[model samples]
Each structure stands twice: as C-alpha cells, then as structure tokens.
Target chain A: MSLIQFFNVTKQYPPNITALDDVSVKIDKGEFVFLVGPSGAGKTTFIRLLFREEVPNRGQIIIGGRSISRLKRKEVPLLRRNIGIVFQDFRLLPDRTVFENVAFALRVVETHPREIKPRVEKALAQVGLSNRARMFPHQLSGGEQQRAAIARAIVNNPGILVADEPTGNLDPATSGDIMKLLEEINRLGTTVIMATHAWDIVNSMRKRVIALQHGRLVRDDREGGYGYEA
Target chain B: MKLRTAGYFFRQAALSLWRNVWMSLAAAASVAISMFLLGAFLLLVFNVNHIANNLQSNVEIAAFLQVDVPRQVSLHIQDQVRALPGVTEVTLVPKEEGLQQLSQQFGSEQDLLAATGGVNPLPDYLRVRVADPQSIQSVAEAIKAIPGVEKVNYGQEVVERLFAVVRWLRWLGVGIIAMLGLGALSLIVLTIRLAVYSRRREINIMKYVGATDWFIRWPFFLEGLWLGLFGSGVAALAVYLGYRLVLNMVGPAAVFVPLIRDQGLLLWSTLGLVAGGSLVGALGSLFSIRRFLKV
Candidate 1:
C-alpha cells in the first residue's frame, strides 16, 4: 500500500528561491529508500517537508490517507508522534539517562506509566545498548549516542522513521553497524527514508535512490547506486 | 490534565527546585524577608494610629458662664457652642450641678467645696468635645467669642505637641515602609528571573520532544506557585513570633506606646500579610517567566 504520496509539490523560501519545485513521488509501506544529492539539492528540504517541518508552496502530501497541510496547528504534535525522526547531530538531553531519553517519547505521547519501563527496555535492547541504559549522553561514544537517539525515535513504535544523515558523524565501521540496524528496523515493517551524502554506503545499500538537483527531482531508481547521480 | 499527569508535573517542579537549590533559596528568602518587614511595619502603623485616635478624643473645651449671666443667656450660649464647627457634643452644666461635680472631684475636702452653703457659687458652663484634637484650639477660640461665655479652656499647648508628633510619625512610617517594600519586590523578581532563565534549555528540549507547550510549561508554573506558598508561610511565622517579642520589649513602657489591645485585628492583619506575600511571590514568578525570559 502507498503510505506516502507527494503530488505536484513545490516549496519556495523567501526572496524568490525555491527549495522543492513540483516534485512528486510515492513510497510503499515498509519500503527502505535513500535520498541522495549534493548540497542545496533539496534533500534536507525533502525530509523536512515529509515531517511537515516546512510546508510546500503548492502540493498535496498524503500520509496514511490524511492530507498533511490541512491538519490544524494543534494537531501537528499528534502527527509528529506517529512519525519518528532522527537527526545527524544526535540531539539528546544531556541531563537525562539513556533509559529516560528512550522513555521520554512514549511518556510525552501520554503512554501509561506502567508501560514505559518495559517499552524503554525493549527499545534499548533493540539498539544493543541495554547495559548503557543508566549512562548520560556525555558518557556515550558518537555511535552509541546515535543509537540512543534511534532508540528514542522508535520507542513509540512509529510506522515511519525519517532519518536525516543518521551516519553523518560516525567512523566508517560505526556507520556500517548503524546501517545494518536501520535495515533490521525496516525489515520489521517501519518505512525508512534516509538522506545522506555518503557515496560508498549508498553504493553498497542498493536501495531505491531519489536524487534531486536545484529543487527538481532528477532521478528515481530502484536498486540504484550513488554513481547514477552527478 | 489527569491527576497522574499533574503528579508528574509536580514531581518535575520539585526536581527543578532541587536542581537549582541556590537560586530557589535566594528567591524564597527575598520574599520571606520582604513580607516579614512589611508585616512589622503594618502592625506598627496600625497601633500608632490607634493610639493617636485615643489621644485626639481625650481633650475637650469647657466654656464657663459669668456669675451675673441670666439662665436664658447661658442656654443661648450652649446652643451657640453646639452649632460651632468641629464641636462633637455639648452638655449644659447648671450652677448647682457644677458645684456637685466640684465636690466629687475634691473628695475628702467636700467641706471646702460646700462652704458656699445652699447658694451655689459655681459658674454654669458648657462642656464640649471637639471632633478632632488638632482643631481643639480653633474651636476653643470660637467658643470664647460667644456673647455670654466668660472663658474657654481645652489645654491648648499639650494638645498641640501631641497632634504634631502623631502626624509626623505616621508620615515617616509610611514613607520608610513604601521604599522598603519596593526594594524587596524588585529583588525577588530578579532572583526568580534568574531561576527561570537558567532552565531555558530544558524548555527547549521539551518543545522538541513532541510534548505540548502547556504540558512542558505547567511544571515551571507549579514550581513558581510552590515557592510562593512556602515563602509566605515562612514570612508569616517569622512576623508572628517577632510581634510577640516586640510586645514583650514594649510592655514596661506600654502607656506611651499604646500598642493595639485588640488581639483579633492583629491576627487578621497578619493573615492579610501572609496572603499579600503569597500573591506577590506568585505574580513575581509569573512575570519573570513570561516577560523577563522566553524559551
């Protein structure tokens, strides 16, 4: 089933500059896709639009058969709760422990207090950081911090996980480990859309690649590699 | 919000208070000390005003009639005294009644007062109470201007000194207390502002975590409320104990002090101070959070 649809989407920043111009695409449920391009190619804008962080100028984006732009401002939090998001910099609260950080997502969405403990434990186990549950963010290495962030993002069992450069700051070995985890998560039926500039990783992944240039969709290929783009 | 949610927010407020213990203590202390001083000042002013009212009504003028004045003339003089401004009450003292009152005052010397025999020699007089002690002099002079009145006496110099001192003390007490109250209010606001500012990072994190703005804000609001209620409690206790100590210190010289004797008014006013303190603390916290800083 098509879980995400962008029909004739366009986004323009102020002063006559366009971020995403008439870009249209569709992704099936549980699909793992790669978004690739050089800087200013609307890769960030594309992910931001999917999360409804930035609205398109002229478009309709349907996620789970609901129009996003028409949603009221108060409903934005409800929308975001169902969609997990991971960042490049691993934005974790420094004061909270690993378990607290993972549990925070469910707690905020008003999950039952009795259910928070087991859910957080399961998320930490999924991230292979169960032993580090009591550690603060400053105590974790770069890769572990990203894993903890992933645990927080997926703790609510969201149907969609949108990652903006999840492996951008890690070493090559750590990046491979994080990609393997993402693949494992995708196999569990959560659609994953990742934007990255890592040519080697994209080449090895051989997933659906959507490439953009100057706010225009230049290529959408299945089993596509990084070499398909300029 | 559910009770569970409210419980969580209250826990968060307590955690934040503990996290910034020094700032919280400073803010609370400022509120307590300010309220204590204000309570003390209010109590002092109330007692002083009470004493001043007592002193003002104590002195009254007496207009005496000449020996040869007819009974009709003395009645006319009594009516004239009653019509004068500031005259509160006027009672006519007939010659015989005045002689009888003189004998009572003379006590063991009744023989000396009754030596005049049945032909009473005391002058008929109009005993007067002026509304204000300060206006006694003017009212006495106006009484002396009456046609049948021979002399007027209301203890001029003593009343003048007393009225002057009470008015000066009241003015000074108000001025000093007002300045101190303003200073304390500003200090409390600054301390609370610092407290809220240091927590802006936590607020920003809450916003990013898909928590509604109100859900994140409620904890901080509760923290402010808790601090205010606690600080006012402390101030009330301090003021209450301090007032007891003051009463003890002034007991020997209480005649001059004339502290308020009614215990009920004292307690109601103390409760008012506590209420006022809590409100100021709560409002200061709100102002600092909403206006001084934004997350």
Candidate 2:
C-alpha cells in the first residue's frame, strides 16, 4: 500500500488564488522523492497539507490508508507523531540544548523518562553529533544546526520525513552534506519527501523528481533532471 | 490525571515568575494594596454595624403612669405589658422607690428632694424591654390602649434614626466589597496578561511542538494561583497587625463602641483575605489564557 496518496487535491487561498491545483500523487514506502519548484510553486503547502497544518480546499489526503481531511483537532497531534517535518529555518528552540531539543520529541510523545535518554543519545549519534549534545543551536555551525534539526525530526522514528527547503540557507558544501544525511535516513527505510530548489543537488542525487509550476504538476520521472521546459 | 502534572506546572510557573521577578513583584504589590484597602473598609463596616446593634439592644420604652392611678392598678398594668408579645422583661418602679433610687444616684441631692418633701411628685413607671428593640414602637402603641396607663414614652424618633443608620451602613459595606472584588479581579487579570506576554515566544513554541492547549496553559494558571496566594498572605498579615495596633491604641474603651468586642471577626477576615487572593489569581489566569489558547 502507498504510504501517502493525494487524490485530486487543490488548495485555494482567499481572494481566489489557488496554491495547489488538482494535484494527485502516490508515494510508496522507503522511496526518496524530491519536489522541485520555484519560490511560489506550492512546495511548502504540499508538506503542510501532509502534516495537516493546512487543509486542502478540495480533494482528500490519505496517509496510511486513512483519509486525513476530516481528522479532529485532538487527533492532529497524533497525526504529527507519524510525520517528521524539517523547516528551512531549522526551527530549533534557542533556549534548549541540542540534546534537549531532540529529546523534546520523545517527551511530548510521553516516552518513559529512562527510555528517553538512550533513544535521544542514539538519534544524536546517528546524526554524528553525540559529542556536541550539550551545545545550544547558536553554538553550532549551519551544517550542525541542520543536523540537529534532523536529529530532532527523526528522534521519534516517524514513518515519513517531510523536509521543506531543509538546506535553503546553507553553503553548497553544507547543503550537499545535509542531502547525504537525508539520503542515509531515507536508505534506513524512512520515506523522505524533500522540497527544494537545489537543481545541482537534485541532479547529483538522481532520485525520483516531481516538478510543480503555477500550482500544477508538470512532470514526474524516475531519473528526472532539473528540467524547466514544458 | 494525577497531581504530578500540576506539580510540574507549579514548578514551571514558579521558575518563570522568578525569571520575570520585577513584573511579578509589581503584580503582587498591586494585589496587596487592593486587598488592604478592601480589608480596612470591611473592618470599618463591621464595627459600625456592631455599634448600631448594641445601641438597638439597649433601647427600651418607659411608660409613666398617672399619679391618680391606684398602686394595685399600676401593678396590674405592668403584668399585662410584660405578658405581651416581644416583651422580654419588665420592672415596676414605684413612686417612693423611684424617689429613693434618684436620691442614691444623686447622693447629696437627697436634701433637694427634702426641700420639696411635702409631696412625692415623681409618678410610678414601668420599664419594658422587648425581644427586638425595633418592636418598641408597636409595643408602646399597644400599651396606650391599656386602662390607667397615662402615656407611653419610648424614644420612637431615636430608634427610627438608629435603624436607618444601620441599614445605610450595611448597604455601604456591600457596595464597597463588590467594588473591591472587581478591582482585585482587574489587577490580577492585568498582571497575568503581562506575564503571558513576556512568555509569548515560549507559548508559541509549545504550540508548534504539538503540545496540548491545557499543557501549555497549566503553567500560567498555576502562576496566577501562586501569586494570589502569596499576595493575599501578605495582605492578611498586614491586616492582622493593623487590627492589633488599633486594638492596643484604643484599649478596652473601644468595646463600648462595639467595634473591638468581637475578636472572632479578625480571624474570619484574615481567612477571607487569603481566600479572596487565591480566587482572584485563579480567575485572572483563566481570563488571560483564553486569549492565547484560542484553539
């Protein structure tokens, strides 16, 4: 069964501007898919819809074979538990240490206090930041901060990882490193749906690419290049 | 479901309160001032009402009999009046007994009575004490219809005026208490709002992290509660000290005014101050959280 299915989904903002138009797609488990588009090309909205942050104006979003369009407010948190979202800003709470930031996910999910320490340590080690766990977000380099954000995102071991411009503010080398980390996470059986405008990184990865333009799906290919032409 | 969660919130609230110490102190000071003023007003009202009640209890109607009425007739009139409804007690003062009591009251004034000793001019009278001093007027009117009773002389105008004053004081007390309660509530709300505003970023982060509304709210609510409890505690202490100081300065003579007699009122008022402070804190928190936790 598909991990996520968007059936004829369309999102419209007020004053009659459509963000996503009749977009339908299916993503299977363990597949690494990159959503490539320009600045206003509905990429963030797509990720938000999957997280239930923004409901689609028309059409259904099915996650794990359940229609998520009608999920109750109390059920939204439970839905978020199954999905990990990484923002371009790296949304790390400044007051918390790197270790605490990652551990926060487990704490919110009410994992046992004794179990939280080991799981947080493991997640930090996987991101190769076990030594810098005590450091705050400001003390880390851009690459380290992004990795810390990824650590927090995957600490709960969610089934799907939705990254929106995860490496948007990073240098080219740092962006490439972050992409590799994401690829590693994807290889470990977590389905990663990353939205980015980095053509070179997308080309180098040679993963399945989906292109969006003016809120419409222009192309979907297994070995797609950064093609802009219709 | 357990109080453990409440404990966590209490700790968080206390930490936050200390972190924002200046604002919390300002809030607490305002609460204390408001409660002190309220307590002072309450004390005044209680004492005034007490004095009025004491005066009312001592009030009685004195009915003077005509001199020509036989001694046996005056005794029969006293018995009838004493048996009437609302008559608590009756004392028959004979003409010669009244004269003798007057001579004793004014010791050397016996010579003045001897100067006019040819006749005992003072008339016999009955002093009636009613269950409620307020019923004196009705009792006097009823006694006027009795035979051989020349007239009934209760202080009708004085009693009416005293009751009027008591009623006014009771209403004033109610009004002041209501106003004070409103002031306390507003002060608490403002203080809590300021605290919430200072922690706005923390609240937003909590929300984005998928924290439930109650989870995010619990800390602020508990903070308000703690503030109210502490502020009221301080006010209650101040009030008790003030009461003691006043009592010391005024001495036992203050009891005649009925203001300082009931020491139980002090305990009850102190308890009220603490309870009021806590209630204001809780209500203020509830009001402030509604705006931030819209979902």
Candidate 3:
C-alpha cells in the first residue's frame, strides 16, 4: 500500500508563477525515492507541500492515509512531528553542541528528559557522530555538520524522512558516505524521499527515481538511473 | 506544564538573554528611564494634589457684620449662618479684636493703622467653615442672606482659579503618564522584535521540528518579563530613595506646606509601577514574536 499519494496537485506563486502544476505520484512505505531535476524543477516545492509548509492550489496530498491540504493551523505542528526534514544548509543552533542539537528536537516536543538522552545518543551513533557530540556546529566539518543535522532530524523517530539536497555541499566521498547513511536509515523500514541534483550519486544508487521539469513530472521509473548528464 | 518543562523554559530564556547581554541591558535601561520618569511625575502629581487639598480645606468665609448691629444681633446672625447646610462652624470676631489682630499682622507697619486716630474701623465678622470646599460658594451666599451681615468674602475669584488650575494640572499629568507608558511599551516591543529577528533561524528550525507556538514563545516572554522587572525594579528603588531624600530636605524647611509624607502610599505606588512595567514587558514580547510565529 502507498504511504504517500499526490492526486493532481498544483501550486502557484504570486504574479502568475506556477511552481508545480498537475503533478501526481505515489510511494509505498519503506521505499527510497530520489527526486531528480534541474534547479527550477519544483523539487523543493514538492518537499514543501509534502511537509504542509505550503498548501496546494488544487487537488489533494495524502500521507499515511490522511489528507493534509486542509489541516488546521493548530494541527500543523502535530502533522510535522510525523515527518523529519533535512536541508542543504544544515540548520543547527550555532551556540549549541551536537548532542544538544539532537536533543533539541525531543526537548521541543516535551519528551521525557530521561528518554531524550538515550534517543539522541542512538541517533548520533546511527549517523556515525557519537564521538563528535561535544563539538559545536562551527567547530565541525561540513560533512560532520550535515551528519549532526541528520541526527537531529531522526531523533524523534519520524516515519518519513524528507531531505532536500542533503549532500549538495559535500565532497563526492563525503556525499557517498551520507548516501550510505540514508540507505541504512531507509533499510530500517522508514520511507525516505530525497531531492538532489547529483547525477552520479543518483545513477549509482539504483533507487526509484521521479523526474520533474518546469513544474511538471516528466518521468518516473522503478530502479531508474540518472538520465541527465553532468 | 510540568515543572521540568517550566525549568527548561526559564533556562532557555536566561541563556538567550545571556547570549544577547548587550541588547538585553539596553532594553532594560530604556525601561528603567521611562519608569523612572513615570514614578517622578506620579510623586509630583500626588504631592501637588495633597497641597491643593490642604489649601482647600483651610478655606473659610469671613462675613463682616454691619457697623450699627449690636453684639446680640451679631451673635444671632452668627447662629443663622452656622445653621445653614454645609456650614460646619462659625466663630464671632469682635471689631476690637479684629483691629488688634490687624495691628499685630502689620508688625513694623502698625502705625499705618494709627491713621484711624484711635477709632476702630474694622467690622466684627463671623468666620464660617464649610463641610465641603466645593460648597463654599453656596454657603457664603447663604451667609450673605442673613440679616445684619455686611459682606460675605471668601476670596471666591482666587479660590476658583486655584481649583481650575489644579484640575487642568491633573489632566495634564494623566496625559503625560499615558504617553510615557506608551513610550515604554513600544520600546519593549522594539527590543523584543530585535531579539526575535536575531533568532529567526532557530525559530524556523523549531517550527520545522514540530514545536508548538507557545514552546517557542515562552523564552521570549520570559526575556521580556526580566527586562521589565529589572528596569522597573531599579526605577522603584530610585523613586523611593529620591522621595526619601526630598522629604528630608523639605521637611524641616517647609513645615507648614503639607507634603505627602505617607510611606505606605509611596511603597504601594512603587510596587504597582513595578508590576505594571512587568506586564507591559511581557505583552511587548508577545507582540514582537507574533510575526515570527507565522513560520
């Protein structure tokens, strides 16, 4: 059964700009999907809509068998708790240590204090950053910073992980390691939807691919390779 | 909320304040200045009202009897004036005693009254005190209607002017205080807005991580509360000290001038100012964070 479904969703910005137009797709639970497209191909818009950050102008988006398009303002936070999000910039509190950064997610959710320490330690260990927990974001390398961000994202044990250009700023070797980490996370029965422009990484992964161009889904293939060249 | 969560909020609030120590101090200082000015004006207005009340209470109508009226008829006129509504007391001042009092008041100029050539020109009068100063005019009119009373003089023009001035000053004081209050409120809002602006990235991250609006709001609220508390608390201390100093300096010199020497009243007012400042600070922070919460 599909864990996520988009039924003819449309999104438009102000002054006659269509960011995403009439896109539809579905991905089942435990699937790892790569969103491959150019810079203005509505990939970010798609992730934003999935997270309920932006509402579709038309049609419905169903995640875990529920329509999120009409979710109330107060219920938005609850909806967001079920999905972990990662970004290219690796947004972390500069003044906080890696351990505190991961624990921040649980702290904000008002989780039991005793549960937060173990959960954060587990997440940091998963990202292979258990020993780097004492370092601040500014003191960490770009790859280490991204690893900490990933740890923060997964600390709450979200069912769905949506990453937008998670390895966009890393070297090829570092990006490869990050991809392995994500694949490991996906292997644990969590759905992972990643948007990236790294063609080489996409081709090697042999994951399900969804391509978009000019706000329209042009192609989707099961176990597809990167079609576009560097 | 649980105690642990409350503790977390306070810790976060204190941490953020410490991180932005300079900004926090600037905001607190602004609040202190505004509160201090408000406190000073309040004291001034209170003392002015006190002195005005003292002056009004001492106001009495002096009804000079007709020169030909006998002592028995003068006494009867005094009783009639005293029987009027709002008239609290009436005392007769015989003409000889009035002349003697005038001579004493004249002091080194006593010989000026010698121009009367041993003839007492001053008329015997009834000193009429009223229950309410507001009713002094009506009571004086009632005294004028009694037989054998020559003229009822209560310095009506000067007294009315004084009352009008007092009323105007009271309104002016209120207007100034309201403006100062607004000034303090906006200053707090601006400072908190800056605090929110500096933490915009943290706020965005919190939103994405499913943090409730209130969870994000609590720290800013506490920050504003601290700013207001410290600012007004300092102002209250300054106001108390300044009032004490003023009382000491003025007490011995102006013994007859009724200053507001009530310690309890000042204490209550300063405490009230601190509480009001804190409320304003909290509200200001809430207002500042509203725009940022949209994320």
* Top candidate (lDDT): 3
Ranked by lDDT, top first: 3, 2, 1
Candidate 1: stretches off by over 4 Å: A1-77, A94-96, A108-110, A134-139, A183-230, B1-7, B59-88, B93-202, B287-295
Q: Is the docking of candidate 3 incorrect, acceptable, medium or high quality?
A: medium
Task: Give the Cα error of residue A43 in candidate 1, in Å.
Answer: 6.8
Residue-wise C-alpha lDDT for candidate 3, range B163-247, written one tens digit per residue? 7777887788788778877887887788788778888988899999999899899989998999999999999999999999988
**TM of each candidate vs. truth:** 0.69, 0.76, 0.82
lDDT per residue (tens digit) for residues B1-295 in model 1 = 8888888888978887887888777777766777777777777767766766677678768788898898898898888889999888999989878776777888734685557664667789988998877688789889888877888887666656665766786787678767755555565566556656676655544544566766766776677666666766788788788888888898989888778767787688678867776676666666666752222
Off by over 4 Å in 2: A1-76, A108-110, A195-230, B1-10, B61-87, B90-128, B132-199, B260-263
Per-candidate RMSD, Å: 6.7, 5.1, 4.6
Write the candidate numbers in order of decreasing TM-score: 3, 2, 1
In order, candidate lDDTs are 0.81, 0.83, 0.88
- Candidate 1 docking quality: incorrect, acceptable, medium or high: acceptable
Q: Native-vs-model 2 lDDT? A: 0.83
lDDT of 2 by residue, A1-230 (tens): 79999999999999988999999999999999999999889887898799787899999999998889898877777777778878889888788899999887776555667888999999999889999999999999989999998998888888999898998999999998899899999999999999999899888999999899999988898877787874
Candidate 3 lDDT score at position B214: 90
Alpha carbon deviation, residue B235, candidate 2 (Å): 0.6
Per-residue lDDT over A1-230 for candidate 1, one digit per residue giving the tens place of the 0 to 100 score: 48999999999999999989899999999999999888899999998777677788999999889998897767667777777888899888888899988887877667899999999999999999999999999999999999999998898888899899999999999999999999999999999999999989998999999998899998989888885444
Clashing pairs in 2: none
Q: Tens digit of lDDT per residue, candidate 3, span A1-230?
A: 58999999999999888999899999999999999899999999999998888999998999888899878888888888989999999999998999999998998889998898899999999999999999999999999999999999999889999999999999999999999999999999889999999999999999999999889988898988777532
